[model samples]
Target: MALGSLSHGFSDWAPGHAATANHAPPKEMSEEFGRAAEAILIALESLRSSVDLAELQREYLTFIQIILNEGLGSVLRGR
Candidate 1:
């Protein structure tokens, strides 16, 4: 997605096709998002060493939940 669209999505937590006012993210929030992205990438890369399929899948889902429920949730709430 375009950066502007992504920023607006985060601001409103609405579908891309929905009409909502677009607002630029603050610099601190943008920096936090960059850090979060980097951390997620590093975690995924580290998962390559896992030797068990079921365990890896479980861990991946947990990671996804943490990102969606906690990480993004906090960002969206401006907490």
Candidate 2:
């Protein structure tokens, strides 16, 4: 997926600004985040109609861990 252009306000910021000085989230990273968020939402919806509560809970936790540990945490750490 193509990286959407940075918003005008962010794009126009002074180089001294933190948002400008620090690298914006890379394009691939941003796209991955979007995909991961969608996956989590889908998982939640699927779990809602699931019959086995324990299995649902296990899957939900696994999904959450992947999002937090791999997706969000890695992003925050500037991977």
Candidate 3:
């Protein structure tokens, strides 16, 4: 998905922003977020910083951990 498509209006970002009362956003949104997450991970891996290599590894792992802990099945379910 294009990065431009990710920018939603204010209401779109609000809690329970779904077609109905659902815990997860729509599948499309989740997929888009997945793409965005990958892009972020790539940057986190490639960029150099004064921060220790261990810190960057922690950041990368933490990002994946957040998504997995949430449960991918729940995250992609459509409202």
Candidate 4:
């Protein structure tokens, strides 16, 4: 997989170029992906109720959308 799209989950977390810079993404991604997912899992576990998790979920989706759109725009612009 390309650095840009590497993720354990369907969600892509790391920025493409940065993800590739440190090492080939797939190798680095396993560790990095787990850490990010674990952090969110921990946050959900800490939450008092499902509502809190839902709120986090919304925010996370929005964040991912923004990243994806930016990446797409950059690509369209030939960057």
lDDT of 3 by residue, 1-79 (tens): 1332233320232233365335444556655556666765566567646477547546544544443333464657842
lDDT of each: 0.47, 0.45, 0.48, 0.49
lDDT of 2 by residue, 1-79 (tens): 0111212122232223575555444556545646654655565566667566445445544443433343455579898
Best-fitting candidate, scored by lDDT: 4
Ranking by lDDT: 4, 3, 1, 2
- Candidate 3 overall lDDT versus native: 0.48
Across 1-79, the per-residue lDDT of candidate 4 in tens digits comes to 1222333244344455675444433434345544555566566676737785677656654544434544455568999
Q: Please give the range of 10 consecutive residues that has the lowest summed lDDT in model 4.
A: 1-10
Q: How big is the positional error of residue 41 in model 4, measured in Å on the Cα after superposition?
A: 0.7
Q: Is candidate 1 or candidate 4 better by lDDT?
A: 4
Candidate 3: clashing pairs of residues: none
Deviating ranges (above 4 Å) for candidate 1: 1-9, 12-22, 49-79
Point out where model 4 deviates above 4 Å.
1-25, 55-79
Ranking by TM-score: 3, 1, 2, 4
- Stretches of candidate 3 off by over 4 Å are 1-21, 52-71, 74-79
The C-alpha TM-scores of every prediction are: 0.37, 0.35, 0.41, 0.34
lDDT of 4 at 64: 42
RMSD of each: 12.0, 12.8, 7.2, 10.3
